[model samples]
Target: MEPQSSLPDDLLRAAPKVLLHDHLDGGLRPATIVELAAEIGHPLPETDADALATWFAEAADSGSLERYLETFAHTVGVMQTASAVTRVARECVEDLAADGVVYAEIRYAPELHVESGLELEDVVAAVQQGFEEGMAAAGGRIVVRHLLTAMRQAANAREIADLAIAWRDRGVVGFDIAGPEAGYPPTRFLDAFEYLQRENFHFTIHAGEGFGLPSIWEAVQWCGADRLGHGVRIVDDIKVDEAGVAQLGRLASYVRDKRIPLEMCPSSNIQTGAAPSISEHPIKLLASLRFRVTVNTDNRLMSRTSLSKEFALLSEAFGYGWAEMEWLTVNAMKSAFIPYDERFRLITQTIKPWYAERMSG
Candidate 1:
């Protein structure tokens, strides 16, 4: 941690953040996209930086996941070569460190980056190289890990899962299945999940965002997801009263009982229409109910946000003071895919002391 900053907002920004649900392709620099697209002879709808940024935000605000995902065509288009991948991954870390993310697991589908004839291993290697460079560039102030993702809409999950295991010590921290979750249930990739289970690998599934409680249930019960991605739809299984009492369905009770982490992205949930607004977000209910909830930025480019921005929005909606913020950050670190000792070191050596000072200030 750095020296204590005087500004309240600065303190919030300086606080240690652990992010488990950020997307690599979904958070590219707009200017980098323009340049990379130009070099690759790919045409974007708007080449101008400002217009391109607006295009992503506006396209993603469609209140529909499928429509919102269409905007990724431009981002993924330019990110084919090794150089592009490394640069994007490097800049992602720098940006996250600037936003006060002390640790982050950025997931990306290697298959998506293979359009340029690069093998899956090649893509993973490039990303690992980039993450290492970024970590060193940050002077070891941040730890950037990669989560190799397999698109649920595709059929290469087993391959990616194997790759994740093979590269686990080589910088890949975990595995994930990402894509539209409606028709493509977690059970569709049961073989991969089962393999991961047998191998003692960690994985998270994209569920209960564009889908509902059923998706989350399958991810947890059937696929055995270590964490849930954008699980805002878990609210569907929870009934609340005017008196603030919540009646949890059997599945909800099990999720809470198991202490499963919900990687909730408030802004992206609203953009994807999973939630009506931040103020009305179920995070407040879940947090109050003591669910293992952690805040995150699902996509920085589309949402035009960072970790601090998400914290600020949540603070406004839930009146979260430093204590609440610290608890949520600790929740994320505790739920991280890293080893137990490393996570503890981060919490005790960095997170706890920083928040203690800020809270008592």
Candidate 2:
């Protein structure tokens, strides 16, 4: 961990942040995973909590997306039971709230948790129950919304889309398709995207993280995604000169012109080898060009980071300060998958006012 001098604990501890991307199955507590695995007779990489945490972090940082995703099997294995799902979801809420997140949108595939004969709705209900419990027990106010993800490798996109629409007014805020991005293009889920579009439901697509500009192009042009999840490789579409002049390719120009929100998970991007390192992260390039870039923790447990840790990394890498952090926070708020009225209310009533007070002090 970097020193807190650049991003003081005072600022990080109190920063009212908005999180756009996170995974439910990817953020379990190591000790909780161990106990849950024990109850279900599921073997774990390590019996000790600290060692297990280290194991997960190391496995995810191996520079191979397939290897990084292997660590999730243990977490998802223990999440098949309803009680386990509820417990993890509630704890996830408490953890985010404690980390000073005022609002968050967490996504996970429900089909991955139905192994023990639980129906799809049962899976969603269990997670919703946990979110309710966590919010009630939160040390402060925290609002959480669920985003249902359909695995690209699986043939359940239509079902997941219907599930998202079913839970729209209940708790599900948006829909997403996550998994291998190379061969399985967003066009494979045409029916699902069409259904969501007809219903006017919000959705985001995982794009341009492991893949390149073509994947991002398909995600926007073909899929009509409301946001681009980890659209780091959109940088591949940018051409820069020795004089620091930048030229945007057609795809990059379209993304910027359309103002599609880019869900940039900086640390996770580096760990996944999406960017060479933090200094060359597309976030700096995209932010400088005024793309609708929002910062996030893609998977807190796997990445072993929080919103604060993400900011701390950005601060050290880019020399960020209060103003930069504030702009990023507001960018996230603007690019959120919520209704305009609610987004404005959060900005004016929650985010802006809180930060304004901090600045005045």
Candidate 3:
């Protein structure tokens, strides 16, 4: 018998999901943004929540990564104060929990939140506090962790890396660098990556999305990234012939051989021009080749998606069944920056049993 038949929207939403590439600032609720913006007197392009949401989706649909990222100014503008940051963080967890996310690593740049004179540590503390409150509200249904990101174009990666290490024991699980990838290569943050390595910390770099193979190469071979954020562009090194055979170049071979996780956000990738569309996305080929591919909602508000919505879209595009869904979910859990035992427990205890029941039923 087949592992499963069709994936209904309800089943997809009920599946236990693990997310690794969500952005804290990028996933705010529409109403939250309007409320916070009004309280802070931050001017917005659209005053109504529905109109603001539409504006974000429309503006982020620009085909350039830089232009797509320009939408963050509004989200980040409303998140300057501590209470605003905490409320956004808490709501993020609540939203993910409602969407059936069992675990998630929400990333944001602390340096960006310091525009209102909040210290880096203070920003981190506020986020952690909100996470704790959200988790408490979740009642053990979902677990959330922070991945402190340093803007790749900035000069404070080392500082952010140190901040991640200091909070490593608390709630911050890893580190990352995110920004326009064309001008700022991962090597520019070599000191931070190297420091994280020396300190025995984990990190994932945003590469192979806005830029191509060189950025991915430097992130993996040079910076020792634990994962590749939005790594859909690794397909650049993969050549396919008319006979339907694919040849992997040195970088692609290395990425596959080492089992580096690729956090692919299908809808968000289409928005940022990483992939032309979901049907033609590299994720189809990469996952077929078993390249440790994992699905994610890079930015819920921008992409107008959730973990469930991403899976639903993939199911429609790729004819994915419960088996494929389970594989992708397991891939994410396995690639999480959390400890091996924790990952194993969640995979074996939580993720596996649910999929097994669904398949058997």
Query: Per-candidate TM vs. native?
Result: 0.97, 0.97, 0.98
User: lDDT tens string, model 3, 1-361?
Assistant: 3232378878777899999999999999999999999998999999999999999999999998998899999999989899999999999999999888999999999999989999999999999999999999999989999999999888999999999999999999999999999999999989889989999999999999988899999999999999999888899899999998999999999999999999999999999998998889999999998999999999999989999999888888888988999999999999999999999999999999999999999
Query: What are the runs in model 1 whose C-alpha is more than 4 Å off?
Result: 1-7
Could you give candidate 2's per-residue lDDT for residues 106-202 as a string of tens digits?
9999999999998999999999999999999985478898999999999999999999999999899999999988889999998999999999999
How far out, in Å, is residue 144 in model 1?
1.0
- lDDT measured at residue 79 in model 1 versus the true structure, 0 to 100: 89
Per-structure clash totals for the candidates: 0, 0, 0
Specify the highest-TM-score model's number.
3
For each candidate in the order shown, give its overall lDDT on alpha carbons.
Answer: 0.92, 0.90, 0.93
Candidate 2 stretches with Cα past 4 Å from truth are 1-5
RMSD of each: 3.4, 1.8, 2.1
